[model samples]
Target: MNTIVDFQQFNNATLEQVRTRFEEEFGVMTYFMNPAPRPCFNKICMSELHQSQTSLEKMQGEVIANGKVSQANYLVLASDIPGIFNLGGDLSVFGDLIRAKARDHLLAYAKLCVNNVWTFYNMQAPVTTISLVQGQAMGGGFEAALAAHIMVAEKSALMGLPEVLFNLFPGMGALSFLSRKIGMPAAEKMVRSGKIYTGEELYQLGVVDVLAEDGQGQYALNNWIKKNHRSLNSFQAINRAKQRVNPLTIEELYDITEIWVDAALRLDERNLKVMERLVRAQNSKVNSDVAHIQEKQSA
Candidate 1:
């Protein structure tokens, strides 16, 4: 469709102003791709990465926005809603783009967006980054948060790899980054099960760095940034040191993601049904266990 670059609001703004606005609005550092919820307005309305729902140039512009913020060494990414951070890539957009034979360009854009987030994650800035999560952060959305040095969430944020539900898998470097953070077993379980998790459960699994009190995830994020500004460089160094020993490289994982994407494109309705059953069965078991724990606590 139209590949127009909309820099109307940003045309005259200085880089530092953009950075400050990004932090103030997202409680992190970055630009939001989707605006307020308007169902069916656009199927794949993700915030962390630019969704090329229309044209490649528009998508590139989104990444440029993130790049501008990153250069300022302040928070570069943030979501509009406090709880549900991002829903991931838009399947309908994928379907449309593929029909138009735009897969190659789309893949390139996806790589650019993924790399942008990775750069943010690997930044040596003392300002650091954070994800204020209280709701669902699925697929790429979840990956974006995991890339951050710290993921602060309220007890209610549900994080997961739900791409399988859409006949795909986490291709946005999530399979590598998340697996390294939470270890293979937990990571595998998350991918295979596509299980959504409470923020407290994520903390227990070490996916969430800081847990919010009484479901105040945004408040926790602001507080963490205020107290830890000076300590960010040290924190990044320590975390990078640990990441260096990890098994998966971005290249290897990106290949795995491509395999999943190709498979998703080839997925038949029968296979999708089977995946749905697997995810549902896993969710049922987890919910039952959670109920048991709640009962025990009440008793």
Candidate 2:
């Protein structure tokens, strides 16, 4: 019972976009996202979101069989992909679909993303969700991290929304969550500016809840868990209260994401070209990460 066991031990959730690990010592379940094919949010990653949700629900049911809701006090999100949390949406797919004028496909993708984000932000279980950012979290990636109740980031981590670079915007709960942290005006400025904020900067901006030294993100997350678990009940109550006072609804995220899909559909050829370049850059990173892993294994 004192040993850390993976949730996969109970429910063998497949890992295409994400992997699962649980520390029974702290009752913390972590989903380490590693979006496959190109380290970006693709269809597989979206489906994996549901897979993760189901896995967590099952875990919750198992632990709550004793009628204790606080048994699972934390769910953490991290990344298995080296040096990159996520590069955001699958730009290649977006470009191809946009060029084909596939509004339905785009809307479908957006809706799925919003739904998952909403679930993470509003988990039904009495658990505190966290994001541990040790690498780059761009566009939808940053939004994904923001979806958590708390974010523990390495100070050197880089994060931002670069959708504006392609004449679009991050529509999946970025503004809603960010506005909750730092006013609406600041959120709007961040979205428009497309500036890549370091973890330290975001901590200063009140976006990052906990900041750790470089390469110590996981350590910081555990330290935080230790510090907060004693007061978990009260803290959770405060979090719930905040939700009541400044609520974020699924409908709100859906509406904004729909607008993003429409804007993407409206992008000129010039904008599509930018997205294409971004995809290429993402591919390069994936390739580099693979090679690095291979080199290490060989060595």
Candidate 3:
């Protein structure tokens, strides 16, 4: 039973938030995330998540097609934007929804996040999933990175859970993933501390699988792949065994999300004000970057 993955769609399809590159030589399919406006997990990224899953599903049991063993063994998730992996959720949307007292909308959004991140955590495909963090990955973004089977981060990359700053919590999959990677006590401390940590610090804490030098994230991952090429089966199997020993079910994610939505709905004006400020900062930075990129292109 073989389902041949069609990479042509990713090559030419009108995907706005993600750019796909198929490394045929290594059975690798890397998707570069570039969620626009702020590089956050916005609505567009949600849709793109589904698209990526669809492609991955097609890669299941993909052994040989057209007389070639083109089975994709690794799927690496990367960021197309420099200096920013993702800033987390759409704060602007959060402010608006919270103000409107839209619990259902907020819950829906959180569930969408849970569903998507869960796929990255448990791809269901034979291929191993990797998160290559090159820059800042905050809140939900950090949670997403934690969901990967392998998290390879650049030593200089900055990551944190800043939900507490605005009187909230990272409710998607942070606690679940972090608890499994490190421990509950450490994960709880991280969630409550609201601290930003460098990739080196995370590697020391055993949260990061592999730590690479600054600006050499891809190189590090390539080297790791080569080193483990012969033992990829054992590597992937170990990841699966770890999950069996301590599983993280989608039901638990949904339960946590409900708590998050309740807390979000209860936020006062002051809390929203804090979120608004962050949103403004994100907008200003993104606009400035866009302008700079445009200037460079035209020059």
Q: List the residue pairs that clash in candidate 2.
A: none
For residues 207-251, could you state the per-residue lDDT of candidate 1 as single tens digits? 889899855765777777678766766766776777676634557
* Backbone clashes in model 1, listed as residue pairs: 29-75, 29-76, 29-77, 30-76, 30-77, 44-90, 83-135
Per-residue lDDT of candidate 3, residues 128-174 (tens digit): 88899998999998998899898999999999999999889999999
> Model 3, 5: alpha-carbon shift in Å?
9.0
Error of 3 at 194 (Å): 0.6
TM-scores of the models, in the order given? 0.66, 0.92, 0.92
- Every candidate's lDDT: 0.56, 0.83, 0.86
lDDT of 2 by residue, 1-299 (tens): 33333444445655556665655667877777777787778888877776676556656523422223325568787888878887788889899889999999999988888877787888877778898998899988899899999999999999999989988989998999999999999999999999999999999999999999999998899899998888988988999999999999998998898888888989999999999888888888888879999999999
Model 2, C-alpha of 262: deviation from truth (Å): 1.0
Q: Candidates ranked by lDDT, best first?
A: 3, 2, 1
What's the residue-level lDDT of 15 in candidate 1?
26
